[model samples]
Target: MKKRAIQILLALSLIFYKSTWFWRVFNHLAKPYLPASREFFQILLLMESGVLFLAVIY
Candidate 1:
């Protein structure tokens, strides 16, 4: 049972690591089309903050 649990954990970790790596490569390739403006990041931050605040309140 311990060996099985370890195997499952390793499998999940591998999947997550690979998916993250793939997305990083994809993001790098798509970076040119993505917004690079400071205003864009600021807006994203404000949006996330508002969402989190609302979540906590409600």
Candidate 2:
């Protein structure tokens, strides 16, 4: 069950990876709480996706 949820989340992130509007909205919403700029957040998300990929593999 947990693995399934992780897989679904990874899939969604990958699907939205190419959509600029998706990132824009996320950046806007997260701006106040997180100090990360758009580019930094994008990189952070990519790193998270990589971790999720590894988790799914193992």
Candidate 3:
């Protein structure tokens, strides 16, 4: 049950990370602090997705 719940949350987070509106707001907030905010966000998303995928598999 616990693992299943974690898998569900990871799936939800994967979906959330793919949303444009969420990134728009994230970039808007992070742009001032980071010069290459979009690139950083993309890398972060990729890493997050990888971790989530591995978690779901294991």
TM-score of each: 0.50, 0.46, 0.51
Which of the two candidates, 1 or 3, achieves a greater lDDT against the reference?
A: 3
Candidate 1 at residue 55, lDDT?
A: 50
Q: What is the lDDT of every predicted structure here?
A: 0.60, 0.72, 0.75
Clashing pairs in 2: none
What TM-score, to 2 decimals, does candidate 2 have? 0.46
Task: Please list the residue runs of candidate 3 whose C-alpha ends up more than 4 Å from where it truly belongs after superposition.
Answer: 1-21, 30-35
lDDT of 3 by residue, 1-58 (tens): 9988878787867667675666888878887888676787788877877776776767
**lDDT (0-100) at residue 8 of candidate 1?**
62
The lDDT leader among the candidates is 3
Tens digits of lDDT, candidate 2, 5-46: 878787767756745667778878987987657678778777
- Model 2: how far residue 38 lies from native, Å: 0.5
Distance from true location, Cα of 52 in model 3, Å: 0.5
Ranked by lDDT, top first: 3, 2, 1
Model 2 segments more than 4 A misplaced = 1-24, 30-36
Query: Which residue pairs collide in model 1, if any?
Result: none
Clash totals in order: 0, 0, 0
lDDT of 3 at 33: 86
* Range of the 10 consecutive residues with the lowest summed lDDT in candidate 2: 12-21
